[model samples]
Target: MAVKTVKILTDDIDGTEADETVAFSLDGKDYEMELSSDNAAALRNVLAPYVEKARRVTQPARTSAKPASRGKSESGLDIPAVRAWARSNGWPNLSDRGRIPREIQEAYIAAGN
Candidate 1:
């Protein structure tokens, strides 16, 4: 005997049939939601301004250990200090946790930290 399975996606907001799945990240966490085309378009339109101005953070390729360890072992720099400095220096989008971006790290080092 053979069996076939079907999966259906429902809009997270309006409870209608979803046309696609949208994936996004916020505050270092990733999320996915199914949405109809109209809702998806609306979401994109709402985020267009911020998205246009935002910097894209590409994660490094992973190995066996945690990604944060790579940043620490390579530089031996203080993460919290960098975060504090960034916040004080007008980097509003820097999150308190997770590996700091390489550009920020370079800036921190260049600033004599």
Candidate 2:
């Protein structure tokens, strides 16, 4: 089966009765489809399942081993302490928003007890 994609653009003009013009390109051809509010809602309903499926396919599966090791490594400091120390020294990218990055972790370990 061939994979097909739809690209859409929307422009809204202020104080207009029909404010939205949805321009979409399909099969290398461009066209504008005007939709009422109700139709737009219906289109969203139809596309919701495919959009969700695409999201699932794009995400990777996680393994049990990674989270376990990330909790605490062979290094003396646990993850939180390493993050704190990194911040105190004015280290770049100190936040543990995701996992503490590898370079910061290496710097922390290199500093030693």
Candidate 1 lDDT for residue 108: 88
lDDT score of residue 28 within candidate 2? 60
Tell how far residue 64 is off in model 2, in angstroms. Answer: 7.8
lDDT for each residue of candidate 2 in 10-112, tens digit (9 for 90 to 100)? 3332222343466644456877765656555666688779767853323377776744565575554587788788888778566666567777888877788
Deviation of model 1 at 69, angstroms: 13
TM-score of each: 0.53, 0.33
Best of the candidates, TM-score: 1
Candidate 2 stretches with Cα past 4 Å from truth are 1-70, 73-77
Name the regions of candidate 1 deviating beyond 4 angstroms: 64-113
